[model samples]
Target: MTDAIADAKRAMRAELRERRHLLSDHARETAEAGIQAQLDALIAERDVRSMSCFLSTTTEPGTRKFVTDAVARGIRVLLPVTRNDGLLDWAVATTDGDISEGLFGLPEPVGELLGPIAVNDVDLLVIPAAAVDASGMRLGWGRGFFDKTLGSMERCPPVYAVVYDSEVVDEVPREVHDQRVTGVVTPTRTLTLAPTRR
Candidate 1:
């Protein structure tokens, strides 16, 4: 992590954010269709219902649609609540209508917060990241929320960070605290398989 590398990383992130905001009106529609189709195939298979999933939100390229669709199909949906402790609290969102934003810009359940659940119960976690590499190392918003929550998992629940195709990179800065995702999914590719053990 030299000064030059850090500067380059910051510049890359800024460029990405700007590009994401400039998507053509048709870009989102195209992405939604492609994303939904890929996810549908994944859901149709038997693996989706095996365990609860933590469905997160995104600002522009976000895929709340995928989460709601899973709920409609009776797949268990877990939403993470950002806590004062700067860690994530996992609770079932139940349905699309069950969500609202918290004090921070992040979305949370409007109803009872409900106690946190065991990470082992989660089979697949649909995480959000600013960037993800081929090896599954993800660069997320520096708040360290996902990193903290992921630290609690007991070697299970394949993590998949959802991002647009352009966000996938060859490498991202990784720290001891940064969590490695199990895979990366673009709007088109259902899964960019990460080299990790199940």
Candidate 2:
């Protein structure tokens, strides 16, 4: 059952990737607007004094402007420094001018790399995702990076995953190491306190 489910999920992602580039201009514009609106609302409501968010990639939901805006709001913006040791480390820096491509061709900080910090120290964590279900289960880019890091954290901080409308679906397969987000902000909706059965 697990194998079949995994294969199905992988296939779904592959299919979507092939079609994502074909998105109509109207669709793209609408989605971007909705995402920006959600980000603005979230920013206004929170203190954001100590928030850490990942620099987004093309495959994942985009949060580049969100990160920059956070910095302008006097919030601490953090970038993930992927280490050869297969653990995620973070560096606190203004997501202003230091952004450059990293190992996976994803944008990351180009400044001093800071060491690991407790998960509890982060007031909010912005995670990337391919999809998220109503149960708050986040489906990342199939990389075990987040799973491995989150598996070790004791008491987790509030995590938010950004996703497009289509990716905010009804169900998704989960693994043992899969961590759930506290909420999801989609291009079209903010499913705060995701209900288990939504």
Candidate 3:
């Protein structure tokens, strides 16, 4: 990636982080509810039997509620465990799954470790993003784990990035390895952007 692009991404990510940090408690709760509803609808619409999702941090759009509910509904949900090799391992999400802080202080599931390839079996992927552009490009939180995973997938299912509605921006800085998602789920709605997956 060019220096200009790298700098742009860093600046954008910082700005988005501040925005998330500044969100009021009431706003966060409302967004969480809305996000859960939109995600539930997406699951129902796609009839997703199994999927991959991230355990949201306090500042990110809430996914813990959705994950627990999905597990209770008997849907197979795999949560990502960050690995030192810049890759991700998978773990089955349980209704009563134990969460521990993983690499980068991100919340991760504690369970039997499933290798990287375990994600290939998922019917959908709901990932976290700092922001997403209209054309589907996702700017993640400076980690390349999700990008690497998506790039290696032989037949990826619909990948959606969860963010607050305001995080749905007109554009985001991109590099050659940055992956595009199939859509984005926000507090207000779900939008299917044209995906460029191979």
Candidate 4:
């Protein structure tokens, strides 16, 4: 990627992070509720049995309740554990275990460690993102963990980046290593992108 593109992504991420941190508690709660409703429809429509999803941190669209509810509903949920190499490993999020803080200040599942390839078994994915564009390109935090994971898949299942509705924009700066998602899920709606060979 060119320096200009990299710089643009960094700038955008910083701006978005500030805006996300500024969201009021009430607004965040309302958005979380809306996201749960949308998730219900998505699960039914896709007949999602096993899937990978992230545990949301504060300043991101909340997914804690949804993760717990999904586990209760007997859907297998895999949450990522960041490895030392910046690759992600998977762990099952059970209903009763205490969550421990992992790298990058993200809360992680305290369960059996499933190797990296475990994510490939899921029927779908609900990943965290700062923003996603109309064409499915996702702008994530600088780290590139999800980008590496997605790119390594031989036949990746449908992947959706969860973001606020307003973060769905006309475009986001992209680079060769940046993997596009299958779609994006906002608090209000799920936006599907046309299938692309990449």
Model 4, span 1-198: residue lDDT tens: 899998999999999999999999998998898888888788889999999999889888988899999999999999999998989999998889678899988889888899999988788888999999989999999898999999898878888889999899999999989989988888999889747323
Q: Which is the leading candidate under lDDT? A: 3
Could you tell me every candidate's TM-score relative to the true structure? 0.83, 0.86, 0.98, 0.97
Q: Clashing residue pairs, candidate 4?
A: none
The CA-based lDDT of model 4 is what?
0.90
Candidate 4 ranges with C-alpha deviation above 4 Å: 196-198
Residue 105 alpha-carbon offset, candidate 2, angstroms: 1.5
User: Where's the lowest-lDDT run of ten residues in candidate 1?
Assistant: 50-59
Order of the predicted models by lDDT, top scorer first: 3, 4, 2, 1
Error of 3 at 198 (Å): 3.9
Total clashing pairs in model 3: 0
Q: Which residue pairs clash in candidate 3?
A: none
TM-score of model 1 (CA atoms): 0.83
lDDT, candidate 2, 91-157, per-residue tens: 7767456778776776778887777563347666777777888888888777667767766777566
- Clashing pairs in model 2, backbone N/Cα/C closer than 3 A: none
Candidate-wise lDDT, in order: 0.69, 0.72, 0.94, 0.90
Angstrom error of the Cα, residue 111, model 4: value is: 1.8
Candidate 1 per-residue lDDT, tens place, 20-50, comes to: 7788768876776666666666556537774
Give model 1 RMSD, 1 decimal: 2.7
lDDT of 3 by residue, 56-145 (tens): 999998999999999999999999999999999999999988999999999999999999999997889999999999999999988799
